[model samples]
Target: MDIRPLRCRDFRILMTSGVVTMFGSFITIVAVPYQIMRLTDSYLAVGAIGVVELVPMVLGGLWGGALADAMDRRRVIVLCEIGMAVLAAGLLVNALLPDPAFWPLYICAGGIAALDGLQRPSLNALIPRLMKRDEMAAANAIQGMRWQIGSIAGPALGGLLVTQVGIAAAYAVDLATFVVSFVLLAWLRPAPAPPGAERPSIKGIVVGVRYAFSRQELMGTYVVDIAAMFFAMPMALFPFVADDLRSPSSLGLFYAATSVGALAISLTSGWVRHVHRHGTAVLIAAGVWGAAVVGFGLASDVATALVFLVVAGAADMVSGLFRQTMWNQTIPDELRGRLAGIELLSFSIGPTLGQMRAGGMAAAIGLRGSIVSGGLLCVGACGALARVLPRFTAYDERTSPHGRAETTEPVQPADPGQL
Candidate 1:
């Protein structure tokens, strides 16, 4: 719904590249899991993929953050995309073999995850540079819509391609998307290193971590996000959920349904500009996500379950918009990338652990019990986060010293209609 950011040439160009890459990423998302099921036919085996890549992802993110601060971010993004495309090609070649081995899939998956970890902080830190400071929240809302569109279309189409032509076709399409993205990226004007950036090193990463820790407001964003994701995410169990519904073909729908909810919310996100208390919005949205997941766990019908997933997805989009706005308006340019890297870890680690938790608990308590209990725990964790991290809850864009530091405009109360 927020369309102003597109007026900037650089933002539009950057978004064009993002749109293409996201489509490719979602294709890989479905292809990898579906391929594992075809090969070994075990939920635990599919879940183990996350575990294998966790360390690589953590390292890539931390190191990538430092690189973004100390080098040309545009170059880093292109290099990472090249790595991703090469890995996709690996998958394609293996799918062509007369007897494709399972291990190649693991290798490709792990490689791609690591590259993605390296790429995200650079991409995230680059966006604010492309647009005005006043447009931050709206820009994030628009970015969320781009991801939602890819999320909705990619899996549905990826599933069809995999089921019809084969995994080779899906991989081929994914590889092609990366090609278009690479070409687009090659033309972007460079975003050079910030002035006086320290060399990329573990010690540099530690300094970033320390800076993030000292600011309780920033920590609030990280803590609440980690808590919600670690406790409530059930995406790793979707195949089994589809199987329980006696509709294996609906597996892709299970993934896209959440996007449907998120897209609906993004279409009307202009109201977010009026919100002065971003931290409060984040917690409220996350609590809604927990509640919706609880509904999904209890759903007896496929339609009901999909609806609940949609609500959960909407809540997540809202939370992400506020969280990103918090980062852009408060953190100075020199520190943005390293902090974004920490932000990347907060988001990425929680989902990885959550998937592992979901898969293990599903094996023990049954899928429904695992999901329901996890949702309840997510709600409790968020409540605890709000109480303990008062700084996050009290973070108002209007008066906070941090928000005022880098803002182009002084915070002011606006008429509900004018913001």
Candidate 2:
């Protein structure tokens, strides 16, 4: 991966903070569900965690986008980090209680989800300010690697801590990570609102939404990603897939396979900076993800199935890298936060809906049938989207008007204000 972005002091600080927080955040990711399952023993109650968090996250993303545009981006991130730390404390305290209440899990989970939604648009929007535009692909790859590392390590450690030491220990570790992240994030330079940026309002949010839809290439990214995830995301079916393949003990591998693949790509992502046709890259990656899922479905052995899943994961990582690059390279600073909000939804909502789609389809068809059918549908959707949105596929970063604008007119920090 390109290391030029790391040369910037602010970028280094932000990346470090991200690395610490992601590890803590992911530990909580495992703890929340585990605690809920232990307390209620109801799959429905555990599943309802997603439902409970969804609305708040959606509202938070929209409002947070507006907030990021209206305030100092660094301040927004710092405040959210503090809020998250408080939530982590809440979880820690509750876990320490002799008789932990069932309801607190849902409350903390929802609150954290909202805060995460709020913090992310600011975080995503802040990246361009931290480094040169040409280094974005490398930066994105590095960030992706950070996430995969956290996803893989945090959960494993979380499981071990929760099971061996107790749930309170897991929450404590998460809380500590937040405190460390807060201090690091506090050191970053101010990223003030764009000049003449309007105060966050429903009207402003609507305008952002309108702008996102008005751009055909932007729409292509959103629609293609949604379709790919909605049709091909099979996490909900992983346990069943393992059973079907007669490797129930290897179920964890199914979950880890994609991350491993994504990590491998991130490790070797130097070539990504050479690619100019980001749109084409995303389209190809999504199609490959679909194809890999189909191959996974058809595979009769665990090793074969895992190979396909890894390919799918790597493809998804490629798609994500370019989608992020496109948004960063094309979007105006004034609208970056709000667009990042929309970008969050395009990626977040898809997987939620996808699991639902997977479960419903698996019941309607058999396991392999659901996986196979969904993969086919994903590919078909990509083909249809490509035909309709030719401009997106033809988009070349070196020559596109938006990319040219980004290159010619670099972003400048607005006058600093009190955080």
User: CA lDDT, every prediction?
Assistant: 0.85, 0.89
Global lDDT of model 1: 0.85
Per-residue lDDT over 13-99 for candidate 1, one digit per residue giving the tens place of the 0 to 100 score: 778988898998788888888888898999788877877677778778888888888887778888898899999999999989998
Q: Model 2: per-residue lDDT, tens digit, 271-358?
A: 9989999888999999999999999999999999999999999999999999999998888888999988998888788999999999
lDDT of 2 at 270: 95
* Candidate 1, residue 177: how far the Cα is off, in Å: 1.1
Model 1: residues with Cα > 4 Å off, grouped in runs: 39-45, 240-250, 363-366, 404-419
Best by lDDT: 2
Native-to-model Cα distance after best TM-score fit, residue 209 in candidate 1, in Å: 0.3
Clashes of 1: 0
